[model samples]
Target: MDNLLSSYSPDFPVASDGTQTFDRDALQERIARVRTALTTRRNPHGAVAILADNSPDWLAVDLATAQLGLTLVPLPLFFTPAQWVHVLAQSGATALFCAQPQQGAALGFSAMTDYGGGLLLCEAPARGGPLPLPGARKITFTSGTTSVPKGVCLTSEQQWEVAHALHRGVSGLGIKRHLCLLPFAVLLENIAGAYTALLSGATMICPPLAETGLQGASGFDPQVCLAAIERYQAQSIILLPQMLQALVAATKPGDARLACLRFVAVGGARTPPRLIELARMHGLPVFEGYGLSECSSVVALNLPGAERIGSVGRVLPHRSVRIAGDGEIEVRGNLGHYLGEAPAPDAWLATGDLGHIDADGFLYIEGRKKDILITGFGRNVSPEWPETALLGTGAVAQAVVVGDGMPFLSALIVPATAAIDAAQIAAAVGLANRDLPDYAQIRRWILVAPFTPANGHATANGRPRRQLIQQHYAQQIASLYDTTEHIA
Candidate 1:
């Protein structure tokens, strides 16, 4: 069990301060100090809830927790105060690590730290000990069907297997300098952007907030991300589908800023093949991937040399996958424990996703098993398929279809660019309908605002919170069926 920190040398690791480059040796040393504090306190099996934004200190504390064998719960910075309180209490965390003093004080955790108290508080130290190579590790609290959220437990061994698989799959591309666009709190980015980079001996660059494309009123600036790529000379990066779309739209032909880029891995939602083709035509390398929180991030990915259009690529070497009789994707190998429950020794885990393997072993993801829309005529329609086709028209920003109880499917579309009028959307929908069966066609639609994470309609990685969005716009959807509204 070699510790994660011990793998890296004591020599100064590079860090960005927006202007000058700084060494991370002090950060490593701070981590070591934190580990000592935890050991001296002798609180085994205690849970620590980390309430912090992305920063050097956050990484240090994470490494420290690994060294100390303490369960670490990384809380989302975007959560409301009441949501934070609820999660902290439900997690039964014995200590709180606050990046902001106000956060701790507001929750009354600051006083607990002062009074020989229930909660211990300390600034994340810079140095830490070596992390164990591979063993059981805990990551909890995943977004679930209910508001309470669910905790997913993954062992270090499971994470290592995934990292190794990804490293092998993308080996043909040579070494890569990965720009981490997704938040580190996400398991997908944490393992893929951090662990996988470490496994591949690649440079893992974390851009400053200003350089991360998350600026201005719209929240993320695609231009800043492109500029950072040029500045850092980054060869690879991870993006959600929405971010990828924005980058594609923002980029122009002959943009030398992307000349050095080797691959842009897009996941967290279904990606349209037309979008991928558009990116490739513009000299961008966008590879699509698929996975879930239970799989330690990526289960399948399209790599540089081995890519299949309209597919999520072949399964990684470290895992085994099979399509059930009903088209559900069931997986096994490198399996881990479920949070709040004991680990299962079975060889298979139901992925709850529906997809089929192509003749060449590529995976074509149809949609979520839970989200299949059944028409009144008994035809099965996966909204993702139609949605992908709709997005291909380049006019629709977001589309969600509902037809579970209705005779005909209906869509709620978010038009791209304010200038694009309803006529443009109708034309796109008409084009999409030309290729779909009569039962699968969108009989009607309602224009709406784009779903976003800030508004709770999307996940951190940009996946649609389908049920939430449906609930929020239930009235609008109902109005689409009104007699006054007409559908061509």
Candidate 2:
């Protein structure tokens, strides 16, 4: 990590958070300050948790922890207080840095010294137990389908390899300025955005989430985001598929506002090919990629000259991917282990995602392995296939297909805009159904409110929590399969 940071020139601008910019020398000075503070107030567990917003100080603390050999646990701002409690308890975090000291105090932490950057260092009593992570440099909690998020332990070497690979992957685009759209706590932005930008000698423009037009977990304002891009002249940025959709909808054909973007890597969910097409039509340089937290963020990505629509593109240099016998995508290379579990003896990490690598080496994700639905007629269908088809239609904002053992599939649809009526959504569904087989078509669907982290239907990164959605709309879903009739 030190070597990677030292490779760049001292005067290169590394980080900015709207209010302050950190060139390499300034960044190093901050890191040194953080390191000194940690050294003086070291906890018994040697673990520190950060619950602040995106800022240059966040990166400074992260680098300082790496140098001090302390495990860094990033607390997501979108997570509920209950979820935060669960993470602090499980990860054995003995120190915390957050803007709200009272909140930290409520979470078993007492106010300690200040961290000098809108964060207060707090101390917690170490629990009496054998620590789960012996060598983990960072423990990132993933908001899965359940209420309690899972922590994935990563070594410094594993993270650096991914960062270096990302730098190599997008270096050709000459992206010297990157705007961070997601939270710094997200592993994708932490490694693939911050670390990669530093490695590539690029400036990381990390304005607050509100400034970047993000609200809580799933809310976004595309116009505000575009304004930030224009203000920063961001040459590159990362986004979720839904964010891409909003931006594409907000922009017109040959929109000059996004002219500064040379690369826009979209992931965190399956991107419907039609959204990519729509983005291209608007002169947005959008590319789809695939990854999970277990593989340290990115596994494969589509690049400029080697573009393949619908596919997530080839695997990164640091990782190898293969489809399991049951079609689960398994990745090998420096994979992180889940906290409290023994490290896998094997090199391969079984990503719950189901995908296939084609003859040309482009990787295509179908859906989740457990999400595949087996109909009453014994036909197996991956929900993402029809969901993608549904999203491809510009009218449908979000689609969740359910019918694990029913006669036909039904969906919970969210319209692209409140103005789009049922008739328009029905027309969109019919158009999407034309390309699907009879068995895979959405036979019945009901329009519902948008899924978001606050609503408990979506993860922080905007991926739908299937189990929660099913439970929340159980009666609505039941009504869809009540009859033998098909909406189509």
Return the top candidate by TM-score. 2
Q: How far is candidate 2 from the true structure (C-alpha RMSD, Å)?
A: 1.7
Clashes of each: 25, 0
Q: Once superposed on the true structure, which residue ranges of model 1 sit more than 4 Å away at CA?
A: 1-27, 41-45, 111-136, 208-210, 215-218, 345-347
lDDT of 1 by residue, 1-488 (tens): 33444444565353333443324465556666666655654344466668764455555566677766677767776555666666666655656676556777676555323312112363222213222112446565565444555666677677778878887776677655677776667777777776776666565677545567864213667888888888888877888877777787888776898898887888888898988898887778889999877778898999877889789998887778899999999988767655556667356888878999988889989988999988778888888888888887778878888877677888988886778898989999999988787888888988878776567776666667789989998897777765566764
Error of 2 at 323 (Å): 1.6
Model 1 residue 15 distance off true place after TM-score fit, in angstroms? 4.4
In model 1, the worst 10-residue window by lDDT is 124-133
Clashes of 1: 25
For each candidate in the order shown, give its overall lDDT on alpha carbons: 0.72, 0.86
